[model samples]
Target chain A: MELRQFCSQSRVVIVAGKGGVGKTTVTAALALAATRAGLSALICEVEGKSGLAAAFGSDALEYDELHLDDRLTARTLAPDDAMVDYLESHGMKRFSHRLAKSGALDVVATAVPGMKDILVLGKIKSLEQLPAADLIVVDAPAAGHAITFLLAAQGLLDAIRVGPIRKQATEVVEMLTDATRCQVMLVTLPEETPVNELIETAFAVEDRAGVALGPVVVNGCMAPLRDQPDSITSLMAAGFSLTTSTQAIEAVAFRSSRHAMQEIQIARLAEQLPLPQIHLPQLLTAAIGRAELNKLADAMAHQIELLQ
Target chain B: MTAFANLATTREIIVCCGTGGVGKTTTAAVLAIEAARRGRRAVVVTIDPAKRLADALGLDALSDEPKLIDQQTWNIFDRDPARSGLAQGTLSALMLDTKSTFDKLVHEHAPDEPAADRILDNRFYRNISGALGGTQEYMAMEKLHELHTSGEFDLIVIDTPPSRHALDFLDAPERLMRLLDNRMFRLLMMPTKTYLKLAGAALQALLRTVSRVVGREVVDDAIAFFQAFEGMEQGFRDRAAKVQELIDDPATAFVLVTTPRRDAVDEATYFAQRLESNGLQVAGLIVNRIHPEFGSESPESLRALAHGNAAILNLADFREIAIRERETLETLTARIPSDAVGYVPLLDEDVHNIATLATVATHLF
Candidate 1:
């Protein structure tokens, strides 16, 4: 598959996964990858604290959009701002003020089920309506709440049958379930627990949210020790006596073992999920920045070429 | 004794927390197993719905109730033939079922069966009670309170959800209380008829605006749900107070877990500093899955020796990761006491079963 074709399959790509799985990193890298493929991308951060801006070596993002590059832009979206936007756009600017003044918005957002989530989803819906960018990537909440976050639209539609909230939720649901409009990309580590959770989340999103699943982004895969024997004996036979340090031997063994385990998990994921996998190498750094992100985006672009 | 060993045996409540995918759940289970090995009855409550804990315990499934590990399962710790039956204490584990816990709370607080049903059957309540933000954290605390008061175990270790929001496990009660005590909530609690008749001019205007924007039905549902809880507010308030008290008790200990990743370390540090501001001490810091120092050889020398051999060069790569991780841990250990820190090097495989968990315990204890 061509990177541009894959990028254009869905206008909105929601990247979700367990915490610490590098969902934010994948979101930023995917946006960069799309932009590299000659498409303008807008990345939306819903949780506000995902460190998306930091991935670009910038400060914290606000509700206002920040253009990172010529073709890439990023912004943070909070529910309160979305609520005010939803009302003002609905010709209730005066009502938005009164509710904000009385502090009922907090009550409604907190006390009512799905109000906070719907407000945000409804805003995203309007963005799609405006065709904000050629591609919009949402750095969604972690896996635990992601199902509920995506299902908030359906939940509201069921709970409130006759209201502007219902009408907004209806449109959000349409945008979410339509494959051409939106698809969810779940990220996970090449480990047992994360892989287990990713498979479960993928199923739940498909069954409940009725959303399409894209290629699974497997992050943090150990670089393979290609064309080299894992055993010290083989290396000695090959005339490389290297130092006699036990730590060196242990390091080789440890890396080989973890790589083997990761391979097993990746195989298990494919057997179960039946989805194409994009493997990202584990960077030997404490945090990801622009350079590391570019490396990941390059890896993603390379994988997309071989995806079929 | 190691700081973790002391806490496992002495602390009545141990809260295991960390950023996502940092092995917090496994740490909690290991701590509970350690407590049980030390002859204390322990139960671990996991907020993550994944069945990893169940798989570790060799169980098909885990419910809301604590299920005891059979003696046969505990026998995995009896590795030495010289000493049999090493696990003298008992261990039980359960996954927190947030919805049922919330439903039980509603039933406990409501004045009668009909009143409870009135709230439970509400469309708004049915949807939000289980899946709302902050509800899982609140209910985890609620279950901790229930288990603590029952006196069934000497120690309770809980695995909180993975995120920076895990801090909410501590603040959910206060946040909920503030929400319930908000003037807006009180106004919403007014019966529809009474609210229309008695609402002040500003409130009336607010209500009209709310109806026009969100639709009258949602407002009706909100008013009806709050009205159903009119007499039950005191009960809920009192329970929240007790939960807060339990959180403040000296017997409760928070254990911070993290990986060598910089973000995870930063989150753990932030969580610890916040707890410090509240005068709560983190009993231990567990750094899971750290890469050990591979060798003393310089990468340049190794690359020269290998003549660009891929396998040997890969060893150099591994060495770099090990050093990078060591540096990350150095920064983390500086913030915590040397005695309070436990480091577990990267294991060969996932800690999926009791055998693997026992292997981790050797490093932790």
Candidate 2:
């Protein structure tokens, strides 16, 4: 499953992983890829992570939707704002005033169990169902809770057997269950804990929700240094050989171990999951921006082609 | 002494707080082992659901009280079988079950049986206790207070839940209590119930609608739960306030834990800033999984020598790992407050069992 092929085919694509595993970066890269493909794409965020905004090189964007380019748009859904929008859409504005005045809104809103999730899902559903956009990519919350958020609509449907709530829940569930139109990708690092969590997340998504699992992107893999140990050791033993500097010896040794560790982790992950695997090299640069995202997009495009 | 070494002797409480999957539990265990080795009677408690401490300590199970480990138990606590031979000074551990702790709080505060039963039996309460983000943090404090007041342990270490919003634990009680104390809910319900008493048929229709939406059984259970907790919300509020005071006390110390990764550091920084803003005493920071800085050599020389030779390459890989590890260390040191950074190197094997923990402890201290 190449990134473009998957993006072109699916309406709802969720990027999820342990926090700090570059889910936002991957989401931005995919959105950029979609835009390059001439498809109008929207990158939606539920947790208000500014990573997306930072990736897009814009600080002025707020919770509302803003166009990143002619074909790409990005937006963040604040739970409170989403709640207000949801209430207003349901014609509860009159009740809102009364509720706010009497402190009923405080109680209802504070304990508004599942309201954040409901609104987030509602927003994603709205964006996906919109005729203007070809794809909607959600930079979802961290792994553990993202599952809960995705499953909330279905859970609510089960709890609420009748009325408008059930109808809304049904619509959300249908969108999530339509595998041809929806796909969930697990983003992970080549480390023990995150990899383990990613595997668990995959099982949970498949078992609970009937969503299709796409390629797993193992980010930040380090390739081992190619060199001979005896010569390096001999050089180190000889202490200042003209052929090698101490810093060079250190750098090679350091890179080699990281590369080996990463390889082991990647191998472990590949064996555990049946899904196609994409490996992203560890970049030396600290600040990743649109240019870096474009580079990643190119790589994803090639991977997508191979998958096809 | 290094900044972290000073922490070992000076700090009373070292709370290992971080985002999830950053090895907070293992780090906490290692710290406790180190403190104990330094002759402090250390006790580590974990509030995470993962229960990693047992695996780290090589223990089959951890009770509500501290369990001792290590072959040199003679150095601190007694290893003898006699009743009085058990040494008072040594390392120990306990795991906190947040839900059970919450249940205990309810039992302690509820005014009557009905109120207690309502809170305990309420579906909402059950869900909140089990799933709420901050409850574990609150419960952790409650347990810490219990251990602190017990006077048995010399040093107490706490491992918080791996929350992206690390400060949520500190803020949970207030958020939960505020929701419970929403004055508008009471006023709205008061008039609505009276109006329903007059318009019985209309009230019945509303009830039917609610029952259908939330499930008749769940609604009934909730009503029963609320009815039991009648007039007891204030008690819970007061207890929560007391707990908050204890958490804010100066004697308690918070230790932020993180890996070298950008995301982990961001979270640690956020936690540090929040804790500092709240006037909480943040003792120090622990950067785990640091790569060691090997002796300097250029990448070209090392690569040229490492390539085409398996042994050379493996050694080169070790050195490269060490170099990256150094970069991570430097990054962490620069980002974290200068006075409060401790470094722990990445080990080859999992730190599972007391012996491995002791090895880790040596490095941390």
Candidate 3:
């Protein structure tokens, strides 16, 4: 139950939530934080987006394990590429090359619903066992697909029953369900829809995959607007014509209420889920570059330290 | 600044495509609401099985069948579209039932009830229908094509799923066709009975050794699923072609939705190019949730009014955010073709109801 120890000890950490809630950014920050704490870490992405490249202020990240910083690395794990790698590592390099050449990798890997996920996770599983990094942080798909993803191994186990696929799925499921080795870290915004999806995803993560749900990182949360002398709404109700200046101030008032609502939602979310929560502030920076990322990384490190 | 009005009005189908968490679904729903308010009967088909769209539309749930918005539901949105003398049209919405849609497609091409049951009963089909890659998007297209041909409404708005596969939605039909048409796949699935009959004992043993990774039973089930399509491949291929043609129609519009973050903006640009490369019509882009800068109020005056108190401090924080967001958005908008971009400012509240969606529609339409 020790927060920092749990974070440090977990071998595979999954970050997921509703899309656009900054899950990728959070993943990068968590990896950066782990590296800061002097732990070898690898952040993984499978969505084929330029999120990490943009975060690192680069052009693109390759499927090859590319270094992000000292003790930190990232890779966009493509299923096709993963299958080829999986085969090659198993001494099927020629067969892998043929599969890639024939355009059959896509067809073969996508044969089942979770076929793609299995390959991606299988590769991650190998990486987890490797000494390349002590922790493997995955920027999984959004809430719905994430559940399907975590359960993919289980699904294959049920369907295939006896084969290499079943054996691979068994390893994946074992690693995923082991609380000491794996954890699901959900990232969400303090909003109705994302919070609702978070609740749904959290339960499914536990009930479906039997994995322990780790800390809930709340992103883009607003700080409280300080108390004022006179209320803007009351002033508006006292019958003054709304000028541009008045309107601007009133808008601020509305935003303050929204911030308060978010605070309440965060509380409600904590009550609803009853898990450890980490809060990330809404940034004032125009763009998140290396500097912003470093700041978030430090804050995350501090949060993990506080988990004790 | 773009011609969203026309795209919202004139197109037979409007696909709001975006990455997850970008308010794409809200935009689609608002577009449908706006079209109806503009006097065009419109229906929005969403892929969020979580019922978020239904909640946004003020309905408890949305099934595959289009449900017309009742008068009571319409009143929840503060504005009166009929009284505005603009739209006065009807609006209905539906949520995709992916499995049922796939089932329907199978049943249609099965050639008979027993044949349909054979494919439908296959373990692979039963387990994989909804979870199959690109199945949701394919079904969304299927529904779009169905609605377009049904003539039930003048407009169909597609809320594309947040597919991590991004461009796969556009080429789903082609991918499916390619897999089905693969000669290797045909050879692999060469029905167990035929395979055993044709292959010599030695050849059969080699085949079994090669296929054991996925299980012999899985191979059998896969062969059953594929062979069940013996006479139906052509029909499915033709249907896939027709779906492509429908998307290629000049009247179709693909609206790329995104946020103004550097990552989101870059992804949007990439998606816009992908749609064009696929030969689909790119109507425009909606950069949603842009923070609007407050106009012309000298910050000095506001600070002087507040006498260095908390109100100005809070307002100043938001003002700074507004200015920063505006800069970031301008940088992104410049990369996009000017005529292909529209803007929606950040709303203080999440777009969770018909009323809120109406507010969004104002900026959109």
Candidate 4:
């Protein structure tokens, strides 16, 4: 499977996971990968996370898109701004501004359950319809809220009998369930809790939200140490200066066990989720910069190539 | 004693807050266990936890009420060398059941049984009680207040939701109060007939737009729900004020937890700043899963020793990670006192059982 083919398969790829699982990073990496594959990519985050913009060596993102590369762009979308945009695009321009000024958007957002999610999803739906970019990747909210976030459309359809809101939700649901239009890619660490939550979230999105899922991105995996001595004891028995220190032996022991634990979780994830896994190596850096982002993007491209 | 240990033992309330996947829940559990080891009756209220962590705390199917960790589980904690000679104390764990907590609050604040039942059975209430943006945070605070007033635990440790909205709870009570006080909310509280008759043109236009947007039916349901609680606003208001006061109480301390990752560190600093703006300060900082400094060997010396062996090269990678982590730790802890910062080394495995949690506590203390 070529990375370009994967990018073309879905107009929108929603990256979701538990917090700190690198969903934003993966979202950026996927966009970068798609752009490198010669596709125009737009990455959007809902939570106004500076990390997303910072990934591309930019400042904080506002509602307007910030051009990151020749084929890449990024922006943050808030529900209120999306709502205003939705209204103005729908020909209620003056009314929308007035509503925003009066702080009625907050009221309207809170007036109905799931209205906030619908507003954002509705904006994304319009974006998808436009074909302004070959790919649109959304950095969704964390897992717990993400279930409710993705399912808001269906939930709203059930709650509201008729109105523009219901119509908007119905459209959002259409975009979500259509496999070619949108697919959610959940990110997770190769750990127990996140893996469990990812499995649960994957099913809930598919079953309840009626959304399609793409390959799971397993972030922070430790690559296997190659050309190794058989064991820590054996390595220490070699009696090098570094090996003589107990901390070195301990470090090796720690890495081995951590690797073993990660392998176990990865196996468990494979057994349960049934999604192709794209393993991203753990970078030993204080922060993810442009260099690390390219490294992760290349890793993703390599994995996508390996996928059948 | 370390300031963290002292804070864990002495604080009446410790709220552990951080971004997700930073081990906020586990850190909360560990602090609770430590408090219990020091002979304080500590209870940890967690919003959601991993299955293994729930099982480890003997709360697999925990209800809204606090469930005490059995003596047998304490025996596991007692086995740790760090626990030797420590006075054994009681530990209880509670999982936050948001909807039920809201139900209890409605029952408590409602004017009468019929009113309570009316609000509880509202279609809108059923949806928003659990799914409202900050309902879980508000309910967590409500539950904490309930537990505090109960006098059942000497210390209460609460694990907040992920950082993006972790501080939402701080404003949740006020937000709730403002929501109740909003003019639209009051207008909606009116009977439909009265609302239409009295609403100004601006108000009418807004409602019309709202109806066109959300559907007339949801507005009706929302109105009915608010009408059901017409007389109970005072009660809810008073309760919200009390919760706010309790949160602002000097005895309630906040703990900022994070990993050494850039984003998590940024979130921690942001959380700390938010707390400071609220006239509160982080009592302690716990940095989890840090790669420890391996050895004194320099990369050049290690390379000479490695002589192209991949495993030896891997050891060099570990040293780089350790150094990067130490630098990151310094950047983070530079904002706070050294004694107030607890950096736990990367454990050999994920903490699934009590034994592993005990291991984390050893590093934390």
- What would the per-residue lDDT of candidate 4 be over residues B73-106, giving only the tens digit for each residue? 7545555575666857888888889999999999
DockQ preference between candidates 1 and 3, better one: 1
Best by lDDT: 1
Candidate 2 Cα misplacement greater than 4 A, ranges: A1-3, A96-113, A226-244, B1-12, B20-22, B50-55, B58-96, B131-133, B150-152, B188-227, B260-263, B289-338, B345-360
Kindly provide the TM-score obtained by chain B of candidate 2 when compared with the true chain B.
0.80
Query: lDDT per model, in order?
Result: 0.83, 0.67, 0.76, 0.83
| Candidate 3 true-interface contact recovery | 0.48
| lDDT for each residue of candidate 1 in B1-365, tens digit (9 for 90 to 100) | 67888999899999987888788888998899888888889999998866678888888888999999886785565554433455788999999998899999999999899999999988557655765567789999999999999999999999988777788867888776665676765866766577666777867777777776667777777777777878888998899989989888999998999998878887888888878887788888999988766666666677777776666776677676777777788888888653578889778788888888877887877
Candidate 4 CA-lDDT value: 0.83
Can you write out model 4's per-residue Cα lDDT over A52-78, one digit (the tens) per residue? 667677888989988998899987779
Q: Which prediction has more favorable lDDT, 1 or 3?
A: 1
Interface RMSD of 1: 2.6
Off by over 4 Å in 4: A230-251, B49-55, B79-82, B85-88, B188-198, B300-308
lDDT of 2 by residue, B1-365 (tens): 55554565566767778876567887787667656655678889986544567766656677766666663632321222231233334778888877777888788878767667767877667766755556667777777766777788778888876665557767877866765654533332344567466646743554454444344655555445445555777877776777677677665667787776555676777787788777775677777766555555544566676545444444455555556556655766665564666667766644545555555555555
At residue A149, give the lDDT of candidate 2: 74
Error of 3 at A17 (Å): 0.9
Q: How accurate is candidate 3 locally (lDDT)?
A: 0.76
Kindly list the interface RMSD, in angstroms, of each predicted candidate in the order they appear. Answer: 2.6, 5.8, 3.4, 2.6
Better model by DockQ, 2 or 3?
3
True contacts kept of 4: 0.59
